[model samples]
Target: MVSGHLFHCRKNSWPPEEYVGRTALQLLDLDGGSPPEQAWRRRLNSHANILKEFSVTFMEAMKMMTLGVRLWSYVREEASHGRKAPIDPFTRERCKPSASQGVPLGGMGSGSISRGFRGEFKNWHIIPGLCENSPVMENQFSIFVSRDSGNKKYSSVLAPGHHEGLKKCNDSGISSWDWNLSGQHSTYHALFPRAWTIYDGEPDPDLKISCRQISPFIPHDYKDSSLPASVFVYTLVNTGRDRAKVSLLMTWANSIGGFSHHSGGHFNEPFIGDDGVSGVLLHHKTAKDNPPVTFSIAACETQNVSVTVLPVFGLSGENHVSAKEMWDTMSKDGHFSRENFNAGCSMPSSSGETLCAAVSASTWVEPHGRCTVAFALAWSSPKVKFQKGCTYNRRYTEFYGTSERSSSINLVHDALTKYRLWEEEIEKWQDPILKDEKLPEWYKFTLFNELYFLVAGGTVWTGQDRTLDLNSPASTSC
Candidate 1:
């Protein structure tokens, strides 16, 4: 009979007080026993030996059964909650019973029931809105001073045009500039143009004096799988003489993306000098695979500039797996020991019996020593199924048991026997308990819970309906 503890959690709760010391022989009527009942007794005796080896008591065994019942109830509630009736819940239209069926149970034989497709359509609306009036395309300026001799020693201040000219100059000129002269009388000053200006032939004492301008880019399509999806960066350098410092500030006119929103994309600062030089970095944000968005810069002193862009991408599918589900499954079953867990589990097709897939990615910053900004992207595909005649059963016992027929018979028979045993136990106690002295609230609650569980537990056989079409072709990609 069902254990009393299944009705309540009081101490000494298993097998009911009356059945505590009874032997199998005492509880069974040998004269009226059937083959199935005899087999059950034998199995119970064998299980008892194993339990004894572990020093497990009858009560403990009963607890396991009770726990199983609870789990069954939970599964039922999960399957039924918020579920609409099948298209033909009461009709045998699509889910006719199998030809050899004998009172099928559970969800067996449920025919292909499509759940429909789901996906995120890439919308360029936000991108256009962001790009339309963006202020990133503007050009700006900055300045750096090496010395502060009251601006008297101010010679030829290096400007943005200098870098352009130097790039076109011969090796001798480049070398001469590299060997920049120092001293109050020295006339030659090293100048790196293009966003930087050297004043008084000395590095700015206030390195914080830097400014930026916003410029909107002409709407142009920029596509590249290797480029950053969202952000970009630019660097600036100062080759002045004095210990100059400057504050850098940036401002821009709103454009496609709007300055208020895209303004934060512009970052400027004094360049780090390994041996006494100056520079700054600029970062920009843009849509994936799009052309470089533009912006402007301004500073008290110009510094050599470099640009770097970082990309971002969409989130991958595997990330959707719930943390709680993963944790619980891992805690109960340990890490998935499957040889290819790291390789990735393939996704199963909508109608596949099984699936296999994986997801991964790599990232890097843009070139030219630009801003230190970042972006990322990820993706995943549908599940793929085993090929026809692949015989996956040979590698996975859980799929088909020890051997096809052997495993099938074992599983079906075990389920049937367990169901029969539970039913019998319920029958033995139902009438008496329902009519006996008033039960405590807790006891009533527990008993009803167990009864509901048994009534709704997994079926021994699946009805004629098949929810998935295992015969269909597997998905080509995930």
Candidate 2:
């Protein structure tokens, strides 16, 4: 009894309020189990009406608005983890991404899915490619090369030039796009626009290329915890309508140099690690003997997302060879492995000009299927050792999975499922929530206050006028 008196408070009691009417039990009966969204909203309408009737500070008004928006969301648990439909909702007709019958990728044990002609008509958003996490604000990368501050993280995945991307999409079947969510609800965010880039080269039946952006939400523990690191996610896929198999051979541009400088490649010192992990270490200095700094690209392959990285080399005395030429010559038999000459190559340079090596990776995908490759970029000076390839998977346990890759795949897959389900509801409520025509901004709050009084107690507007009646007849006592 003493311990309880000293340390505990009553769990069943209602918290104290400045203006109170209902008892604890009464309030519990009114707002329990979220019982029917409309019924609950009706309970809050009375105070909302009073607030609407009087002018208040913006901060106070926003608090009320936040409550109303959350009540309107009305999302349930069952819908969030639902299965994904095979076909996308936004596509027009179907996608038959055609490409040249390109030669297989040399020494990478996979063929190339060249950038090709996408079908004549296609929807840019709602295409395939899994994603994780969102980034906003001016970081180091965002400051210099990427000028996408303040916009949604999903928007950054498209070409930096938004207007040109759309025209190219229409005229030559190449498109760029993104997703958006606001007013602070998980389900609503899922309904945001999904944007990606399309590189449709020509109409060939053999190969295809598609790119999509994703801004993943970190688990609460990771987001709130001090992890001391950041993650940037970019996802791409290979899709084909007729065949059931396709391969993607991607030659990464000089990652450190942004996207344009391909000849003086940005990566070197390639190495493979245990599991489906590959990495390259980059280190160089200027002529004046600048201090050496290092950057790394560690590629990880999950079950449905495997990748094979191979080094690119050239003939003796030659600086480098075209990836196309190397692919055609080395993959003549339709297969190759690390035993090939260029398997572990790197640029041999002291002045940082000649012998610049570019690295690439390939993945085999199902036709109309997807392959997500996640790379981590970190800086560790020459004094610090580079992180191993498998480290990326460990850091992103939710994406790479705790036990199996299926669980990780389901994380974003289920989110997309919920978004697709809520798409129609969002359309219905867009105008109402925007405060333009359907309902004035103040009315929704007033309605909320009216219901709030009814549920709390009949104290606000119950009729209690006084009156008395007179009778003429009287009876004798019995």
Q: Write the per-residue lDDT of candidate 2 for residues 1-478, one digit (tens) a residue.
A: 0011100122221133211222211221211101111111111111111111225688886887865454334222212533122222222233222111011100000001111111011111100111111111001110001011322111111112222113331211112112111101100001111112222211122222222212221223232111111122223222333322222232232222211123343335655544555544444331112223233434455665444444443322245554334444323322235443235536544223322222233344454444444433332211111111111122223222333222222322333223323323433443344444565434433332222111111111101221111110110000
Distance from true position, residue 312, model 2, in Å? 4.3
Q: What are the models' TM-scores? A: 0.15, 0.32
Give the residue spans of candidate 2 off by over 4 A: 1-195, 198-241, 252-267, 286-290, 302-306, 312-324, 327-336, 340-347, 350-364, 367-478
Which candidate has the top score in TM-score?
2
Question: Where does candidate 1 stray beyond 4 Å?
Answer: 1-141, 144-241, 246-478
Q: Candidate 1 residues 1-478, lDDT tens each?
A: 1122212233222222222122221222121111111010110101111111124578886877776576566435534752212121222222121111011111111101100000001111122111121112111111222233334221112122222212322232211221121212111100000011112212222211111110111112111111111111112222333322221212122122323323233222222222211112222233233222222111111233221111110112132322223222222332222332222222211221111111111111121111111111101001111222211111112232333223222322222223233334433534455455575533532443333111112111111221222222321100
Residue 55 in candidate 1, Cα distance off native in Å: 94
**After aligning candidate 1 to the native by TM-score, how far in Å is the CA of 25 from where it should be?**
99
